[model samples]
Target: MTATIPLGSRISGERLAVLLGEWRRRGSRHGSTDLAAAVEMYVLDGQLPIGTRLPAERELAAALGVSRTLIGAALDRLREDGIVASRQGAGSWIAGTGARRRDLEIPVTDGIFDLAKAAPSALPGLTAAADAARHDLAAYVTGNGYVTGGLPSLRSRIAERYTARGLPTTEEQVMITGGAYSAFVLCLRMLAGPGDRVLVEQPTYPNALDALRAAHALPVPVALDPGEGWDLAGVEAALRQASPRFAYLMADFQNPTGHRLDAEQRERLGGLLARTRTPVVIDESLVELDYDSDPLDGPPPLASFAGELSLTLGSASKSHWGGLRLGWIRASADLLDRLLSSRFAVDLGAPVFEQLVLAAMLEPAGYAALAQRRQDFRGRRDALAAALGHYCPDWTFTMPSGGLSLWCRLPKPMSTRLAVSAANHGVQLAPGSRFGVHGGMERWLRVPFALPSEHLSEAVRRLSLAVASVRSCAGVPAVNVPVA
Candidate 1:
């Protein structure tokens, strides 16, 4: 017999709860049937995409505030419908769409509105910068083109950037990489190993969690409240108890949460790391997108507070264009050496032309576009908030001072279900469950302002329809059965 390879990322019980909002009808006797139909809706809509693993029965019962018998019965119903498959030891997964597909009335639309990613289009003037870099590339054409550490031009620009942000970085401290995520991978490789505990925010950038797991590093989560911001006491305890090898943090306009660690908070957090003698990788990918104040006038980079133990990651993906595929790491000279030495196992170096393009983008002349990009994003951010207010009145969110997405708290814990229904309405979403480590946060959703205003408005309108559809699903009566 073959061992079970993972079907796909496991959907935690708490996450499944978010997907099965109000599954049972009031006073319905056949709760198992109701639960099964709710689960079936997700499967049919491709929300629980094929091969997606499901929570264990006991876990599901706890999450849904029901009994295991109810969950088991529901699973049985699902299996009968041919929508799910299970093995004794391997748990269960979505297997097929079942025979009900043709009967459902799925809303039709020509194009899908995507709010699943926070990435924006290339900064205006990227083409002009690329053209300038194209001419500059001729000089490097004569060389081997592998600047392992990074091209001096790009490194210096990034170094000065750190200085402006109050880190006092030098050219020697920075190592350019393919992107912020790549920079994270390189650091993860150098600092952690299998079974090692790496501290992280509870609802963090999902990709970072994936990378940490891929490296076999166990992530120790510290709870983060979107409204309240980081809980330093909790972080301090996790550091002391878990003794994580290092922490991964995003203090500036933190992803999905939009909570910035104020200067005082950073000082306190930095001191905690210093006292713990723990190293940290601070992902500053969203640092440049501040909407209210100058990025410089804001709190100093957390690295400045954290001292030598911090490894700071910066990227052009959010500020400029993702296509440039460029980011860099600022670390102590000694740590930078180790990260550089570890690069041999990966590809040679970041592509030469892209690096040059980023270099040109960082030039003094290119800052006008950066400012313009920020203005454009600020407008987009307000547009999304307005749409949400207009279309989803009960969906509450703090107006983020920065960041490309808004973290909205839904009136119902129907994020996953709403996502499935939204897909039918031609709108894509990243539900709150994707951000949590152990699978929860069902009451929330992250909506990006990356689309045009018209598109954003329409998407929210469709989302409002999806919300209604979910309500309709909850209202459908299940086949009668004797109550246990």
Candidate 2:
């Protein structure tokens, strides 16, 4: 499969120059080191993918003006580092192991506790709704089995929720897809073409990066300020400069930082977007997950101020169950239709039974039954924070006012390495750069507090041990250790 790099990918021009310069400064005593650096340069430049066959040792040596021995040694080093592999007659191939995507599963091995995902346990009423939907599914599946815009009832429920939130949306303005991610792609296809810029926040959602890349829209990530919570001014600056086709901003209970844009900032951003005629894709996936603050007194949704240029996405996966695989989008009637038409190329909308189940769960009593999950998450958040304070106090983090994860800024830029180390100690952590734009953001870690309280407490303890191990390995004195 051919992988196309975004037009403005960091793998271009100046960054390439910097990488070559750095390698040049590291004088190769053996020429093999230089050849190893060249292979890395090719990978960094997007010229190689997993399993790409490299030129034969003699061929590469002749091309690079190096000896066959140097090429052989370089290939050996690359193999040892797991960056490449070789076969008897096949020469060497690039191994795309920078990171591997693993299926989401419950952790049960090596006494490990997974704090990697931020999702609540399925609440009480889902099964009842599911059972009710099974009858609906049996009847619904008998008809023409293609679903393009999802079931109408679920779309209506989604639109009603947006209208109730002050977005003035109509059911006709809604379309359903696989999940929030599918909704995002549909929006991208409708609003952006290849090479068109799309705005995202720095240190934002990792999967969104993958989505944007797959959509072929260049992601222009504006920085999010940890001090101010959300970056309203940065949004305005990016809008003025990039003139992106669409901007993906998390206006409520943002994922990693748990920062919600206050009313004033929301209005300001909404107005800025409106004036610039830029479509703002507001992802409110975590809206049902406010913890310390009550949204009853908060300002209206950004869509209220964005008018026709706003697109809203919501999912049952984060708020309900990932297994549900249901998500919806609210946008202008014209835009909604365009997205729906473009979506047929992706997949037949979400499963009919899942839609019925989600719609049933959106009813008043069903949602109330799910509210208990927020309280449960709060307990785990508190437990994890308290454990971290008592154990790994040196690692500074802001207790998120709401949302599933805490964004912790480590004292050093070793988060990826730290995650590998943490896994060795029976815990998994997402490296901060996973949320970063291009190849930035290394001095951070995102820990989810959405697990059971006991599990979260134990995860924090293991995390503390991991930090100690990393610090000992680095020969650094731990500072700012918090006391309970």
* RMSD vs true structure, all candidates: 9.1, 11.0
What is the C-alpha lDDT profile of model 1 across 8-113, one tens digit per residue? Answer: 4466799679767788874457899999978876553334545567889989989988889888888998888777788988899876645421122323356888
For all predicted structures, in order, the TM-scores are 0.77, 0.75
Superposition error at 284 for model 1 (Å):
0.6
Model 2 off-target regions past 4 Å?
1-111, 293-297, 472-484
- Which numbered prediction scores highest in lDDT against the true structure? 1
Q: Each candidate: how many clashes?
A: 0, 2
Question: How would you encode candidate 2's per-residue C-alpha lDDT over 209-327 as one tens digit per residue?
Answer: 77788877778765566656655655676677668999988888777777888788888888889999999888888887777644444567889888798988988887888788778
Model 2 pairs in collision: 147-349, 393-482
Worst 10 residues of 1 by lDDT: 475-484
Clashing pairs in 1: none
